[model samples]
Target: MSGAFMGPPWQMDWVDTARAARDSLPRRVRDLIDAVRAELVTVEDPYFRGVDNLPDLPEGCRISPLLSTVPSGLHVCHFDHGRGWIHYTFLRRTADPQIVVEEVFWQ
Candidate 1:
């Protein structure tokens, strides 16, 4: 198992990368991403808070640890906004309480 994640105030790493991806998306897709952000902002830890309360998420969207990457145990918050899925990986730093988003991938 990975080390314990510190609490609250999620942060994103390489935000510009995510932004550029968002900028290239169609407006409808962008709106979906916006909606995900809106939902996420309401909670302190998207990965740990659990998705049971996020009613807006599509069928496959849920918070789960990456199975293939066990031991490292990276947690992901998956959301299917449109035809694609937005997968966010959360990395916890020892010194920070914020969950640093290590990556955001659309697939």
Candidate 2:
């Protein structure tokens, strides 16, 4: 069996808010979410690969670990919407077999 479960991160309200505002969000923002969601379906090694940790992040996306904002393995990524970048956090646990999307910063 696959040891991977993709769902909402820690702060679901934030993610929910994003979904609620999807229509108003920029194309790149929507694309970022769509791409992330798609890649998560078949979670494997290099967990964040193709989603955040990729080769030459598509012009608008930038994923980096938020040293102090989260724990050791958590990360914060940015997806640009032409003018600015939307930040969000996620968790990838080695033993849990679960990927949690913590929160998103639209502003």
Candidate 3:
């Protein structure tokens, strides 16, 4: 919500720390993320958007809220099929409709 004007409904971007973490990942895992990114970029609110009360998770990823520190507006999307890696992202205010990647880690 800073002075910067947002352009689209569902834009995807990563903070520097998150970008570094994603950069360190191998190609296959990165491919999973790229796939998720494609889906996320089309959803207006990845954290809250849903249909028929089901969670709106990107394909190949399972999501849960990040509850330790910043509880609200923060979430982790983890690989659902036997993978231990997790990707973190958060949405800003309506004026800045962007999903900002917060972190990436392995569990």
RMSD after CA superposition, every candidate: 5.6, 6.0, 4.4
Predicted candidate 2, C-alpha RMSD: 6.0
User: What's the distance in Å from true for residue 68, model 1?
Assistant: 6.7
Model 2 CA lDDT for position 79: 58
CA lDDT of 106 in candidate 2?
55
Candidate that beats the other on TM-score, 1 or 3, i.e. the better one: 3
The residue-by-residue lDDT of candidate 3 on 1-107, one tens digit each, is 46664544467778798788778888877777777776666654566545553444445676667765555657777763636455556556546567778777643
Please give the ranking of all candidate structures by TM-score, highest first, separated by commas.
3, 1, 2
Tens-digit lDDT string for candidate 2 (1-107):
36655443322224565455654677766777666544443434323454454644455665556665544465555655434343344444443434445554455
Clashes of each: 0, 2, 0
lDDT by residue for model 1 (1-107), tens: 35676554455443567677876888866676666665554465555543355445445456666665563456565666334544455555655444344455665
Number of colliding residue pairs in model 1? 0
Name the best candidate (by TM-score).
3
TM for every model, in the order presented, reads: 0.54, 0.47, 0.66
**Candidate 1: 10-residue stretch with minimal lDDT:** 49-58
